[model samples]
Target: MMTQLLKVVPEPQAILRAWMPFKSVVGVTSVRTADDYVQARATVDALVDEIRADEDHPLADVLDYLGEQVKRYEDVHFTIPEAQPREVLRFLMEQHDLKQEDLADCAPQSRISDILNGKRAISKDIAKKLARRFNVHADLFL
Candidate 1:
């Protein structure tokens, strides 16, 4: 006799309804302690996985809830620093393998060196030149 394997498929609507109570629980616990990280992350991961696995799942609702949780977690943990002008210039130069001499058409090599060495500020004129050369916003270098 051959035995058939039974797959326990959950109804999407039912899963969504079950998710609501869990979401509330996670929301209440999200700011409590470092211990909450594992639980919160697990809840989000499970919801995302379920949504991916079942197209019939309330994808928009799941995504919205997951996005909120992710934002909350990131707000608590991630802090991005503002990039300085010289650092931006150095990053751009390194990305393009540009030499200081190559920037002469844009600005003087000494000016580029001074900016990179934190001895000079990026003036509006140089910012525009860099913007044009790099095809990026001037604010990036400012």
Candidate 2:
């Protein structure tokens, strides 16, 4: 015997209906230029503030769409300055609450400590491994 967990999804038409009214109300569109991008980002922040304890409010999808627009604009226009490998490593470790031993799959604990402490440079091979483990671009570690 197996236990099954079922979840309900809103139908396409229902989702479209829910989205239609708010589109005009919020004035969201495909963000093509900088001004539109800024407006959409502001809209996303406003929507985030508006949504209270109810996580399932119908406006969640609109919030998601707005966030996607901001991300698309950033991908095209914004470039993150290259960071030192050790800074990147330290940031990832702190952000993820990981310790040196946690990354032993990528290298020995001592090597990880050395990399994080800037005593060693990250080789291309180790960069690739770290990128895969952290789910980030390899260039971030280079």
Candidate 3:
């Protein structure tokens, strides 16, 4: 029995079309050092945020691929140190564009200010409310 081989060469136009979105992600599909990896990581983060904003986004695969590249680079070069609860709280506040007054339902504005300034510890009930408000784990506030 003779085995038959099918030639499956991709069309040039199709290849170009597929490559169009990848123009900004120069590092993911190639070997990269620390600097390029950082740049790619930032690009991937922005792309992920953009994709997450749309429920039926057409760029999901691109986001997934970018995430994988970021994970790979992070596995080799990234070191994340544990942050204090206050720092985490501040980060969440910044991410949500929240001021102390915005968290009034969670706590008094003065208490929120004290927590941010490290003058007060995050209380259990306040942590729970904050967790719900920020949509993050309560332990982050704890």
Q: What TM-score goes with each of the models?
A: 0.43, 0.44, 0.44
Q: Rank order by lDDT, top first? A: 2, 3, 1
Quality of model 3 by C-alpha lDDT = 0.69
Q: Judged by TM-score relative to the true structure, which candidate is superior, 1 or 3?
A: 3
Question: After superposing candidate 1, which stretches have Cα over 4 Å from the reference?
Answer: 1-81
TM-score of 2: 0.44
- For model 1, state the Cα shift of residue 128 in Å: 0.2
Q: Write the per-residue lDDT of candidate 3 for residues 8-65, one digit (tens) a residue.
A: 9999999988786666445455326777666665665565445533536787666556
Q: lDDT for every model?
A: 0.67, 0.74, 0.69
lDDT of 2: 0.74
Steric overlap count per candidate: 0, 0, 0
**lDDT (Cα, tens digit) per residue for candidate 1, span 46-80:** 55544542436775465455446545765677532
Misplaced by over 4 Å in model 3 are 1-81
Q: Per-residue error at 89 for model 2, in Å? A: 0.8
